[model samples]
Target chain A: MEFEIEKIAQLSRLSLKPEELKKLRKDIESILGYIKTLGDLKTGDIEPTSHVLDLENVFRKDDVTRINIRDEVISRAPCVEGPFFKVPKVVDKE
Target chain B: MEKQLYELTLKEAIDVAKAEGPWEIIRAVIDRTALLNPRLNAFVRFEPEHFLKKSRKSEDFKGVLSGAPLSVKDNICIHGCETTCASKILRGHVPPYDATVIRKLGDAGAFFLGQCNMDEFAFGSSCETSAYGAVKNPWDIERVPGGSSGGSAVAVAADMTIAALGSDTGGSIRQPAALCGVVGLKPTYGRVSRYGLIAFGSSFDQIGPITKTVEDSAILMNLISGFDPHDSTSVNQTVPDYTKALARNVKGLRIGLPKEYFVEGIDPEVETKVREAANVLKQLGAQIKTISLPHTAYAVAVYYIVAVAEASSNLGRFDGVQYGLRAPGKNLLEMYFETRNQGFGEEAKRRILLGNFVLSAGYYEAYYRKGQKVRTLIRKDFEEAFKEVDLILTPTSPTPAFKINEKISDPLAMYLSDIFTIPANLVGIPAMSLPCGFTEKGLPIGVQLMAKPFDEEGIFRAAFALEQEIRIYKRKPKL
Candidate 1:
């Protein structure tokens, strides 16, 4: 039941303060114990439902107008300057 | 305590206020919202003038929610409006078009209230991750409202908005709705269109209602509960007017109690309250039966794996190149790296990284595929249980609302809050939470109702039955 806050943080990609880590560990361990209940099941043949519809292919007739963005045909660049979508540089390197 | 404006149900207020012309309801809501914003922080964005203008433009003028105010969860896109999903990555990202559901609501003459706050990227179980401040519970300002849809729940509970449309990922909608003592519905996946809902694990996401009463939830459900041609995932099946079904009654409907859900961690008073609701249902003529969802224990782990894996893939669009907020750098990779680094909240980054880690080349089979396999088992559990009964009933969460700092420290604990609600999403079944009863301490408790696939009507009927008996519709938070 030792929740590794650093390990979970590393796994989760959080930059946490030194103060927050101690509290996070205890909370996560209880939660992990709770979620661990899933390990007890014997589920081999059940077909998982990723989507409600078992059917595939939402084919539409070619005549139907579905978002004909101007960029599809008229794409050189809307605001390309020197091989980039130009904007002022943000996020200065510290 | 004496008929707090914060506690008044929208219908009761409607009687008192008399009529809703000139956005009277919205004005009263704004005054209340302004009062609660400092403590509750429910609304992420509120624009009075723009919202009032839209409020006055209701075409039908006599439609179900006409003049009745509604808030959109920040994740759903509104044309010419910001939908950041409480994520910095999409900060200032205004959608070019309205979500199909939004269009339907607009056509039905519902007033537009501001976008409410949520967990960043719809990733958390509590309202702690928004770029804006976390939303607090109306019952207790220091506690977390269960989230990704937490703000939607808070708004409805606090009487800031009559109803809200929130997207459920895992248990985003129902969990918070349970926490805040409101009715939240997660319709069967594909029952509602995902066209305008910003993606967070697309297969598992759905948009539904958070409301003060079962009736409000039903009315809002009728408005947004249709298929859209724009989304391939939207079912081609006809969407029924759910409000009609609310009056059908749940008498003789079989209510199944899964043995596994009742065994552990669930608060005793929550159990008492849930049992109380079950007893009331029994008194009202529904048969209460003990049923087995033998594989029920594995919901959270399986859900986390699939959800994070899908999230990792779905969230890949946030690189610095094409759309949304970007932190520029010399080259694409640096720009991509920097933007994501500064943009996403800690929890969102955690899930994305977990998603990436789970979907990582070597681990995919063990975590992702195995999780999907377990997901099948969880769905099988529900399917089997449903055969023995018409609907399943359970406590919406193992515990009542928790203090703000209670679970923020642990990602796993936050994920656990969605335990009861996740299996419904995994199975693509319709589930809802209604205010069943409260603890002696007065914290609200919620009871969940789940129906077999495409049986949202059964869900409404069942909830309406309990909603009448539980009768918390009249209760208000003291905030």
Candidate 2:
């Protein structure tokens, strides 16, 4: 059971050291190997349960009741410029 | 006098507070936290001022939990207080608003004791994954208090707090309660609102109580379990006064012992004690019968897939641009890489990667989808078994609390410890761990009682019956 370890880590937004990647590679392989046994069970026609309570499409009144703590929320951000959260540039400047 | 105060259960403590005033109870809890926290490492940060101020103003208050100093697991948000899920990624993230549970606790007049320690992001079965350091079991400082609720359980067991709240994804509350010798209840999923709980496995996580007795757990449950407009998944069922369910005779109750739970890996002492607990329940008028939850064998495998899949998606909120720790890097991608690399611990990284792998393009159908299908079978197993039994009894853990680093390097072995407890979370039912007996080394063992969804009363009635007969509450760790 082999995998593209670096690819998965990149997708996960994690940067692993070389040694850490080596260890994770082994762990993932073993865990995936164990999970393979689940294929033996006959789950034909059985629906998957995503949420236990089976709640669906709940809607509430959309009245814009005043925002109570706009300042407090922005104040807790790691980096904020004025009233908005500051972030790195999403697009590279040409 | 301090020793006597420390020994008081939540109900007993409430009575004392009523007679002498709330300040007396607050001072006793603070004194105990000061003396025991350094050695036990049960708390990451304590807001003594918050508790003190609350107690001072609570002079005229006479609510259900008034004067009780309750510690909370770090994952639950408190306004203006840091709510790091014991992860470096969330080093200084303070929530602007209070979690629904915090608001309810406040309304009930329970004082905020402090932020207790836990596994980072509630990742590990043992509490060793916390960035703050492992919480040592009060019974034996060398052993781990079972976690991610380790600190919460330790605080209650060591008398540092009257009661504490912990989140259960898979046995976080009960396993630690078992290891530390206390009562831990995981209310049915959606029975307690999860609006502010830091999501581990969103479908599996529920915040519940770790306390000194079943009645105290019932009292806390009444306060915490209710429908919240803030949480969509919160059920609309009417919440019962759980204390009223206690002490009802179990004479006609039907108890099922799933053969799958009493398998080879279980410690002999744990098996004997749990079996003996069954016999005691039988003598009290309950009939014991062997039952089969055939799908039990697949629980752990299915849990990891579903939990890690949800966790991967849930943990994505922690990238560099948000409230947690940020790392300096040349570009946006590098910043996300470096920040998460530095912020998350080894176990957190492992799960994130595993989660992404299973949910990734090619593997999604086989791993994540099939795992969900298998989960249905596991839930169906419980649905079928409940027809023949009123409750299911099993060992909370296969063995007692092990030494701190025993299974840290072995993830599979560590995952196996939660085998019995995980099924309850998967099936969305109420279950609890009660101190049943002890090991030769004097470590406490717990027996698990599980009932159908919303039937927490069944669990309490049987646990209270056995607890009355065994008198396990009289014993305490020498700590």
Candidate 3:
């Protein structure tokens, strides 16, 4: 029942206002309370099922197939510079 | 008669297109959509001029569904069209290429009608969570069409399009289809390629059809079901001609009625109608038996844990640098925080938070791993029951659609609505919802049919037979 809503939101890369944090805390508490029902059934020996089918190591031939959608993909970005997506400066200036 | 062309099912429209060409049908559907969309809010983006222009050139196109108008859920990619998943963050993100299903539909000459609205990030069971606004149920405008795929079901129910494609991750397709009195199928997980579906619980998501008739669903399954090398999870199993499965014969078929699903808390009317559907199948020479999926009680809990954990990982891509909305910030980390905080709706944020909490360091072993292990048990329950029956029957939703704001504020109540439908998604099996009957207030009820993994043909065989016997699909809402 004790959820650190601010910490979770921060981990999720989401900024939450104070009121929003309050509401999210209440909702997450109730949802987690419901989710706690899974503890009743013991799954001691069962293997976890990540994917239903037993498909592994699905490697395609390394041959290159030309799909030229550079402009189309780049055009959707919110900020774009010539042939590259523009982003905020990450490194600190010396 | 031409004015009612929008009412034609996908098969009927295909035949009409062959004789009269695709223009008349296209124009009829466009006119119908224009008239109905304003009231229903089913379409987020409808382009009459675009469809008309395409219809003009479709005269030379030929295929099984040649020139049939198709409505796509906003979550599915269409090369140049905005695929937003009905959320603010993805509002203007247009994909550079089509989803594999979209490509197949295009090759089959199915002209796009437009994108239908959905719950933001396919999160809510009621359509109220859609950022565009809630889609009103055509059955009763005050009520909600069930969520996530609500717009697709509404579009098909109101005859705004011949057929629509909807992705089901925990009953997104079937729940809405049931509420709207249309047929919806969630194919076996790997039966259809997931190359272009915007991921929401990657293991649970599967794109399928919502249509007026079971036969139309079969036609779409034929076109969209296949292995795509692009999606490694798509099974290499051979895709059968599903239309051939619509033989209307359930004689000697084994149908199991799960005792857990028929218990208390279900609307009496929904329970009765689903039981009646089982009897109808029984009378048609099929054997009906009582079955137990004992782990059913824990399906919702397990689904919430596993699905959200996967979704949180999949949704990590939505930072400001790429597609969609960008919020201003001084630093790179601040940019991500601002963008996500602004982009996500309340429900999306709640789910994302829950996802992060469950997968966070100390909680990982208890929540995520435990949920996955229980998921194995749920799958085993179905595997054991399939040994007794070819298909399992249950109610698609606990009740017919509720009032618009009824469960919007209460997230737990909304999650419980999908209790019967979630197990199929959890187990990666094929399941469907078809119109069964109506309530006293005229709301439609649907009965669910679930089959073993890769046994969609069995589902079609039983559903097509019940559909023929009951004829519930003939009833339509006066929108």
Candidate 4:
């Protein structure tokens, strides 16, 4: 039951300390070990159930019915600058 | 000699409000909450003045639930109020708009008392993972209130609020309600709108009521269950007046006791109480039969894989973005990693990592896809069984409320606590947990009643019948 805890954490965009990574590896292994029982079930040719109800694409009249809450939404951001969300620079400076 | 206003059931409080006015009822609950909340830790946020303002405005709204004091799980957005999902990542993230259920509750005149505590991102069976703190079971403060909706259940059980709303994505509602000795209903998937609920397991989540009695559950369901254009998945079916389903008769109704649920590893008392509940229903003219949901053994495994996969994807939006917590870093990816790493609790991190692992490229077919396929088998098992029985019965939890720190370290053990309740969420059916009896140590035990998808009416009728016969609702915790 080998698991790449660091790789998974990196994929999940989560930083983990060495000790935390060690613990998580053991925990995920046992959890995955238990989850391995699913492999025994003969689900061959069975259609996957993503949603229980037969969901069709829901459409509505193409009319503007939503109220604009721009300020209200922007007010909740951790870093806001005049109605816009401020984030760390994505590109490196030359 | 009369009951305190805070101690009255939702129906009784409503009746009293008809003559006495709604303010007095609100005050009683406010006072009760102020007095008991220090010990219970049920509410993550309880501001007396905030409730007073809502109650004042509620005076003019003459809706069906005029002036009812309710506690909401922290995950559901309340517009202008912090909706954190009990996770630190979203600590200050107030929503710009109300969740559809909040709007519905407001229109019906139900005012919120405060946000209740829960497992961070509704990840654990024990409410221990909440960022605010663990919600102590009203029955025994040392024991955990069943989780994700633990605080909601505690508030109802302890009379902190008349009734509260909780979201169930694998028994977040019913399991806690059972451990706390109250009524918890997880309505059919898409039966209740999930418009404002912070996503955990999208396909499985449904917000329902936790209340002191079955009738209160019915009353709350009527107000909240409906089609919502806001939530695309919300079913467009006609919502029934669930209050009409509380007729005190289970005459000739067939109830199935799934043989798989009654197996070993269940607490002897829980098994006995559930069986006793079945007999009580049988005595009242319902036909009782033994049935099997053969795929039951794989439910917990399938649920963790499928639910966490959905949860991992749904949670990706919280990466130092438009709202919630942001971490400083030289690079954007570093900020994303730092924010999530610092923000999520241990349980939340574990689930997120597992979720990504299963959905990762090579392992997708092995874990996530297999889980989805096996989930179909679990659903088909119920579909076949429902043809023979009107409702399925089982213990809501394997045992009574456990000590606070008992299984928090053991994630697998904690996951198994939801074994019986997980199948209902996996199958997307309506199920309710009602107080059936108590263990010798005075801890509450719950028996579950599950009905076919969209048939909450059947569950109500049968549960109401059992509740009336047992009169367990009359027994309150001596907190």
Q: After best superposition, candidate 4 residue B120: deviation in angstroms? A: 0.3
Would you list the rank order by DockQ, best first? 3, 4, 2, 1
True contacts kept of 4: 0.87
Report the Cα lDDT for residue B128, model 1.
90
Residue-level lDDT of model 1, residues B341-458, one tens digit each, is: 6787777766675666666666666567778878777776777887889999999999999998788766787777877888888888999999888888788899999998889999
Clashing pairs in 3: none
Model 2 residue runs over 4 Å out of place are: B1-3, B53-56
- TM-score to native of every candidate shown: 0.88, 0.98, 0.98, 0.98
Clash pairs (backbone) in predicted model 2: B251-B285
DockQ for every prediction shown: 0.24, 0.76, 0.87, 0.85
Give the range of the ten consecutive residues with the poorest summed lDDT in model 3 chain B.
B52-61
**Cand. 2 TM to true fold:** 0.98
Candidate 4 wrong stretches, greater than 4 Å: none
**Model 3 lDDT tens row, A2-93:** 58887898899999999999888987788889988887777889899887886778988999899889988888899999989998889979
Docking level of model 2 = medium
DockQ, computed on Cα atoms, for candidate 3: 0.87
lDDT of candidate 4 over B1-479, digit per residue (tens): 77888998989988877666677888899999998999999999986576465545645546787677888999999877878988899989988889999999888877688999999999998899998888899889999998989999999999999999999999999999999999999999989999999999999999999999999999999999989988999988999999899999999999999999999899999999999999999999999999999999999999999999999999999998888889898888999999999999999889999999999988999999999999999999999999999999999999999999999999999999999999999989999999999999999999999999899999999999999988989888997
lDDT of 3 at B9: 91
| Candidates in order, interface RMSD in Å | 5.6, 1.2, 0.9, 0.9
Better of 3 and 4 by DockQ: 3
Angstrom error at residue B378, model 1: 1.3
